[model samples]
Target: MPHPNFILLYVDNPQQSAKFYAPLLDKQPMESSPGFVMFALDSGMMLGLWSKHTVEPAAPKIPLGGSGELAFAVADAAAVKALYAEWQQRGLQILQQPVSMDFGFTFTAVDPDGHRLRVFAPYDPAL
Candidate 1:
């Protein structure tokens, strides 16, 4: 099976979500339309935002949050803390503060459409 290289998030408004994510991800939408927007990430992964109402087959009626999270992995605990501070200044709705869990140092924030965004540093037993 092929590895998934694209991730799509169902959003209330693609334009609004694109605006919110563009600067944060430091990438402009490679494609945009009334109901859809797409960004190409540095890792060759594609992130797409599609209007919830317009998605074919229809999306299930799930709340905007607590379904799943898009996680970004960073280098270390300090990087996690640094980003937490920066995101705080930018007013991302923080759901979890920086803390060390069994997996690593991590935190969770939410986008305007209530999609969970997580930043973490993988656990390194050494250092």
Candidate 2:
């Protein structure tokens, strides 16, 4: 069984991308280079930032979920709101305000590369 545990995002600038991501991920890159940086996420997933112009043989079509929206799961509604407020203060481009939906309270923000990062919590009717 093949397990996918890594995600790669091609950015125009790797260093800048790492800087933008560090605070959000609450961690720093485990490895870095002039053209690449790798972040070891707490969820046991690895995120790599690579220069779009320098990938070997060039990268095939990038999969960004219809608009580069990356959904990040949160602990709950409060966590979602806290993140929304935090990212809002950081001045990232906010695409949507936090609101209740089929999933739960959630919001969307845009990264430096125009990637839509969504934070969502699972809905539960029970208190």
- Prediction-by-prediction clash tally: 0, 0
**Candidate with best lDDT:** 1
Q: Give every collision pair in model 1.
A: none
- lDDT per residue for candidate 2 within 1-127, as digits (tens), equals 9899988888889999999999999998999999999999888999998888898879776654234677899899999999998998999889899998887889999888877899999887685
Clashing pairs in 2: none
Clashes of 2: 0
Candidate 1: segments with Cα more than 4 A from true spot: 125-127
In angstroms, give how far residue 119 of model 2 lies from its true place: 0.7
Q: Residue 47 in candidate 2 has what lDDT?
A: 93
How many times do residue backbones clash in model 1? 0
TM-score, candidate 1, is: 0.95
TM-score of candidate 2 on Cα atoms, chains taken together: 0.88
Ten residues in sequence with the least summed lDDT for candidate 1: 57-66
